[model samples]
Target: MMKNYHNSSLSLPRRYAITAVQAAAFFYFLHCSFLPFPAMQFPFPAMQCDLELSQNVIEAYIQIEEDKIEPMQTESPQYMSTWTWAYMQSFQEPSWHRALYKHLLEKLGKCSVLFFPIISKEEFHFTLLTFHKNERKWRHYNPLRSLGHRKEERCIDMARNFVNIVEGWLEYIRPQAQVFIETKKKPTLVKQKEGLPTLVQKDLTPTEELTLNWIMQNPLQFPFEDDMECAQQSVSSLDYGMFVMFYMDKIAQ
Candidate 1:
């Protein structure tokens, strides 16, 4: 029966067509098993798979580039304006004003007790603005009008007046501030002399010790030189004098 079926009279064209179909199906199976299917080869022809994939890649690249860029730095406009104003005033103002402004700047830079230990540059700038406002008041009031016409004479007179006022104020407050410091147990240690050992002690009250240290370290060096006529001036304005008095009260408290 098998020999008879093989010898059947099947057409040559029909047999060739069947063999070609079989070969094509075999190749298709091999391609699907061995190779990755590209987007174009996807069965769903209407879906935008290729476009979605390209968009994701582009978005990822953009995010990576954004991460590589550094953020911009910014400064406070108010602070910059105040600093500029102070810088200009220091150069353009009179000698007395320049001296006082320079003294304040040094104190602010050092974070002195005068500013209540101002910790930030911004706070120092704010204090400077306060000083400027007080200066304008002093100009309006003209406290030294009776002193003299000459700027030098006025500066010397002002310094003498300041020394008198501060001395009187210190005399009044010394006892009280001493009591407060002792009660609070906050005595400020100070070096007696440049070469003295730290173990060396001084027989001084807390108030006297603090006062001596402050004078020694004071940037203005009040009573500037031994000569009253030629000494560099500081805090000539009454407004600034009152300002110092207010902070001194705070310190004593």
Candidate 2:
């Protein structure tokens, strides 16, 4: 006797369970492929600044980049990833403007703080609009001015400082990066097979060379000179601030 074709002896509960599992699997694939779940409110939990630093602070606004070598994953063992920090300057001097600068410098004098020249964004913006013949519309807004706050006129340092400091103390103690100067090194030649053919030595800008001189003086040694090549690449590519603070709790420790 052949088996009962469509009427198997499987229990009713087993049949229902199979159907339910199939439905769940179908919905899971559908959601994964097509549904546009609310654009993942980025970063899980948002970052919150220390209230003390946010209130009446001059905001040193340091843009730091640290190259991290990731552990073995897949076929590659090492990957380069960046870590950033923006150190805020404390409310120190009586004169808001002068204090603005003194605090910046004081932090640099502590450790691994170096100086470098940056582009003139204000001038570049003016030039860009002057020559922009395209039809793209540009909107410029000043949040502070819109709120009826007068713009303060002051002279700020063209060269900014980068400080490497400890973490978790921004709420209490003032931060610092204490820098030292040492002799500069010669350019390094790298042989390349692609792009501009021929081997070329990467030359340092005068500012970078000078900064290297200053950074080498620190007793707390860092692999800065070796990383200078990569650092230059980072500075050119990234939209970074003038003042930078490097937190060294993880990398340095």
Candidate 3:
């Protein structure tokens, strides 16, 4: 019995040619049915000017140059997630953090002063994040409150200002880097305990140990200068996820 012609496969080139022809036919029909006014049908009007003057006719032609400015790109909230995670993992290296700080300041200097890093419970790493103020003043603007998902919103704004955040980190690392490097040469001691974050004490030098002790000894302070202090204090009264608020407010202040 002979195979059906329609069911038989054609050569690759022939198949592509037939597909091209069918696609062209489909488009042509679609154009004819929907777009009655094709470019050919709507011809340009002849450029004719009625000026009875000598050869001194001042002709001015407007030529539009290509736009040099690039269109702004829309990005998802987690666009910097991977890069930020990597950067955070490299926090032990002071040089890496310093380089990133310089780069972020130079590149994101134009970003709003209100823009700051925040780490959600789900997104546990810090990233360059921005929250637009719909119509309120910068001091009154809070993104978490603006987006009405109070239950899902479990984020702590790391700093009131991004500049302050970067500057603070750089300052903290400057004096501690040499000590941290020296301590890192020793064998690391890790102790895992239930209901507690992993404690790594072997990684700290004598100086770092003393510095850490001093930091832990210091009490939390609420400076009068911080604009967000009042708002933060209002929210800090809440029993849950307030640790970050307390810690960041104390350090950043």
User: What lDDT tens digits, residue by residue, belong to model 2 across residues 192-212?
Assistant: 676533433343334333323
By TM-score, rank the candidates, best first: 3, 1, 2
* Predicted candidate 2, C-alpha RMSD: 25.4
Best by TM-score: 3
TM-score of 3: 0.24
| TM-score per model over all chains | 0.20, 0.17, 0.24
The positional error of residue 139 in candidate 2, measured at the CA in angstroms, is 37
Q: Assess the local accuracy of residue 147 in candidate 2 as a C-alpha lDDT between 0 and 100.
A: 14
Per residue, candidate 3 scores C-alpha lDDT tens digits across 1-253 of 1112243121022343344344334443233233111121112222111110000010000001002212231121111111232344335544343334433322221222223333332322222233221221222112223223542233223334433454465456445545555565322324447653343444434433433333334322222122322222122222112222222222222
CA lDDT of each candidate?
Answer: 0.28, 0.21, 0.28
Name every residue pair that clashes in candidate 3: none
TM-score of 1: 0.20
Q: After superposition, how far is residue 216 of candidate 1 from its true place, in Å?
A: 14
